[model samples]
Target: MSLVVRPSPAIWVDGEPATALPIPDRGLDFGDGLFETLLVRQGQPVLLDYHLQRLQHGIEALAFPDCLPRARDHLASACKQLIGTPWAALRLTVTRGAGPRGYAPPERVVPRTIITSAPLQQDRDELSAPITLGWAEVAWSIQPRLAGIKHLNRLEQVLAANEARALGVDEVVMLDARGLVCSVSAANLFLVEDGRLLTPSLEYVGIAGTRRRLVIEQLAPALNIEVVQRDVHAAQLEQAAELFCCNAIRGLQPVSRLGEQHWQDHPVCSALHAGYREAVAC
Candidate 1:
């Protein structure tokens, strides 16, 4: 499929007016930036705090100047631009403005922040249905420091997504070097085994999902569900009765097929989806 190219919106670079970013921006050159894709519903940005907190955390990790206020201002402006628009997806990006031709970062960095909005997605509800999942041949490298953080460096996820598209699957479930389940190319994974909910720990792999946290916090207690974090291999997934993938944007998606492994209708995933919906509504 062709890459989706949405029109770029007005942006702010170091508290100034800009649209096209500079060529020497460290974000484009070295992927030294952080971004958050927020769900805008009813003209409100869903989980705004979570997205900003993550962005701030990522900026600190990269030792970039604090660009939260500027980013927030730009985001607010973009949301105002979409006043009559019912729904949309907003992308907020903060990059280390520009640097020399070297690995070392500049001393006084002026971060560039961009906020853009597009037509809202209709695929959010599709997660309630079953989805096809495939395994990526590209094993995810274990990076504890980078784990749980969303950064601009996502070549691994991009490649895995391509592999999934080639395999005709909705998503690709990636494994680490130790042959343990990590996550899908873009979302987190969960399996229902022996009446308990289990997911791979992000301590050594995968991104810490905002939706995942909500599921763990709200649904785990109300449903009396056990949420386990540990190593799970391909074999375990094959033997599992039900599976699902989730992200704040996508919500919860049931898994119907994983390569040749076919899963029958399972109530656990459906129940989880119902519970998650209630939580999000609340």
Candidate 2:
């Protein structure tokens, strides 16, 4: 799909056009930045406040220049401009600004934050039917320093995607350095076994997705299931009754097949999807 970029609410440095991001941005140079992808439904951006809060937390954690309010205002205004679109994806990016060649951050840093809106894209088959997943031989490194944060250094995900493509599957299930299943290449994974829900612990790797958090927090109570975080292995899938992956952009998705294993219609997955649809409607 062709993307259309719009002017953001505020531009701190010289106030030109927010659409024109510089080439030498630290985010591009060394992946010294963070980003959040949010779904914009109708005119209102879904879970916008949460995305902003996470962006602020990441800025503080990474010691990026302070400009959260400006970024927030710009994003709010940009969302206002995208009203009446069928569906949209708002990608908000924050960089540590242009810096020297060395690793040391610029002493006086002016953070560059950009908010762009584009039409949301979805795979018809995956959304309608269960998706097929595969095991990724590429192992995720255990790095607590960057764990749970949506940092720009995404080589692991890229490699995992390549492996999944080679395996001829829709998504890839990744294992951490310790040989425990962490998550899918792009989304958080969940398993259903004996009416209980489980997901991988993000203490070491994987991004804690906003939609995944919402599901575990708001939907688990209704299902009367304890959403426990633990390590999973490829062998453990044999015991799981249902498997799925989730993200803010695509909502909850069911994994009908993973490698040689195949799953039929699962009640838990249906209920989860129903609950998510209700949540989105509300």
RMSD of each candidate relative to the true structure: 3.2, 3.8
Model 2: pairs clashing at backbone N, Cα or C within 3 Å: none
Model 1, total clashes: 0
Compared with the true structure, what per-residue lDDT tens digits does model 1 show for residues 30-95? Answer: 898888887776556777787788887787778877778888887776667666655677778888
Going through the candidates in order, what is the number of backbone clashes in each? 0, 0
What would the per-residue lDDT of candidate 2 be over residues 1-282, giving only the tens digit for each residue?
Answer: 778674333332223345477777898889898889887776577767667777777788798767888777767777776687656777778888889888889899877777666775452113446889988988999998778888889999999999988989999989999999899999999998777888988988888888788778887777777788888777887569999888877878888898778998867877877667666553
Name the weakest run of 10 consecutive residues (lDDT summed) in model 2: 7-16
Worst ten-residue run, lDDT, model 1?
Answer: 6-15
TM-score of 2: 0.89
